[model samples]
Target: MSDSSTVLKYTPAEMMIVVAARALAGVRTVFVGVGLPNIACNVARYTVAPDLELIYESGVYGAQPARQPLSIGDPTLVTGAISVTSMADLFGLYLQGGLVETALLGGAQIDRYGNLNTTVIGNYDNPKVRLPGSGGACEIAINAQRVFIIMHLKKRAFVEQLDFLTTPGHFHGGTSAQELGIASKGPQLMITDKALFDFENAEREMQLISLYPGVTLDDVVVEIGWQVRVAETLSETAPPTTDEIALVRGRLSSGKQSGGTGEA
Candidate 1:
């Protein structure tokens, strides 16, 4: 068990990163998205999953970036990579070829079935807030053996329906993705600051599996737009260890370009 006092020293964002990294403890290969997912993968390499191979969309495979990469195309990712190939080969040979084990993604909006929306906040043509459209997320989500989504849990982001489906999750639940010939097993886990959710039920709806130490069931439920299901044996997420907190903080503070706005 981690010391309670030490765990309180870290911010929620730091905790989220630690929790997300822990999810990849045994994963051998990961298709890493920028921002928080990148940090999580980097942290995992230093801690639990040292042999983890990180693949970026910008053609780097088995990347062991010395510092945080600004984007998928950042030069740091190519520094110590096993193979630096073209974007086409990386996507076609690795992702679509079904060689990647897991993909880590983030979204502006997510529905009960884990469908993601990163295109726009409102109407597509007019729009309330224009977002960075999917770069390779659609393909990665569709082809990775399994996918993990990491994002902040908010009422607006966790909606009943997405404004645009940039990436397919379990479409309408059940075996929809399989039926539609989507190669990957859609959205296996969702890691948020408040809680960790899993698509363990038959219908593939997000189920509350565990809560962060200070967060309550009500806290998570109130933020979700839909009536979410809770696991029968819900557990508390393990608090970030002193070492985990230190590693995450050290990496973030190392002057590497973290793509997103300090969300991790």
Candidate 2:
């Protein structure tokens, strides 16, 4: 347990994970993706939501992975899972069935409305960098009750318009997500390295509500492509407690926790 006076050493990645983990506190079932989302959900299971059930897109439900999984096909996701069904069932039964409470997603680019682009960097016909097309992310974005996006914030990443729209967030703004048939309350929160945002306004735009202890408003504004919207009363997010850092390191070992600070 960490005392109030203690200052634990942690990386920005670890801090982001801790804050992202905290956001899933009361959720019962989560459709977790790979990478940082996986790590954050694992930490949440131990700390806040002890009964949290993690559903993987690879058809593993209620997964209790023995260790960190490298990808969706990692065998560890199946070893201790409640059930391993077909990918069709995982999507049709749990995800689209309206059973999942939260879904975590990330992409190469995100717009002001939270639409994600994981497809390509430039024109689809003649691409600059061809990205892996969306696998189950588009479905997760559409079906989950609440979607949480996790990615490091950078000017190039948080763009005014995506190079290509791979997954819909809020679309044009109010009622657009509903009009587009996205069932989820799309991207309720976006946890970045410098600040935290919540889509609580009518437009469903990313609104800065909290900043990391040492970061400033300009620090976030300068890194985002669109004009940043500020919450009326901005709050500062506290550094991770000793206990949170320990949990994050437990699952994210081997320098994974100490990796890059930015989206790139």
Candidate 3:
């Protein structure tokens, strides 16, 4: 039995974190990018996926950080890690070697095809806002067995086409990833604050699979830049249960809030 009378008082950012964490329920090993992805991985570890191994790009593997690390290079990640290897080994042996089961990533821009752009906001030559260029995200996006992208549902962020393709999704749509010889399956899900999406369609376009509580199709449509497709069996995403909320809040209570860079 679960507590049914628990009050639902949470922010959209918190909801995103809880939802993203839930997506990692049974994942064994996750190559975690910084920001929201990092928080989600730790939340999942404290709640549903206790044995979840976290691998950081800075070469920390199976990291059980006492507190949320500021970045991948933050020494706290290496505190209780299983093995602190070199960047070359981590990428060559684990990520590209196909040992990583999943990778959680965030992007500045995402298209209907799930292609991500974290390079720049505007023109590459004369950029509007230069973002943190893809640091291991390109490799993780193409090499991880499965990739989960987390971002907020905003009109600007969810564009029809990216200003730049920093990380490949279903490149130009279709079997292009396969044709390009990408060994790992890409862009499994795109978790957002308002809705949950999956690239289950034959075209590999992002399809709205579930909507968060109180959010409607119109709301999602208004936020996305393109004419987003809806799932045939569209469903409402389950609200966070009492236990799930507690675990997430507890894990994030160490003065580290959930919101991160560029909606991800």
Model 3 ranges off by over 4 Å: 1-7, 255-264
lDDT: the better of candidates 1 and 3: 1
Residue 178 displacement (Å), model 2: 0.6
Q: What TM-score goes with each of the models?
A: 0.93, 0.93, 0.92
Clashes of each: 0, 0, 0
Predictions in order: lDDT: 0.87, 0.85, 0.84
Ranking of models by lDDT: 1, 2, 3
- Candidates 2 and 3: which is better by TM-score? 2
Q: Mind giving the per-residue lDDT tens digits that candidate 3 earns over 108-187?
A: 99998888999999999999999999989999989999889899889999998799999999897778888999877889
Clashing pairs in 2: none
Model 3: C-alpha RMSD to truth? 4.5
What is the C-alpha lDDT profile of model 1 across 1-264, one tens digit per residue?
Answer: 243336547777887899999999988999996777887887787667878898999999988776777888788787668899999999999899999999999899999999999999989999999999998999999999999999999999999989999999999999998999998999999999899999999999999999998898899999999998999899998898887776677645374534332212
Question: Which run of 10 residues does model 1 get worst, by summed lDDT?
Answer: 255-264
Residue 32 in model 2: lDDT:
86
Q: In candidate 3, where is summed lDDT lowest over 10 consecutive residues?
A: 255-264
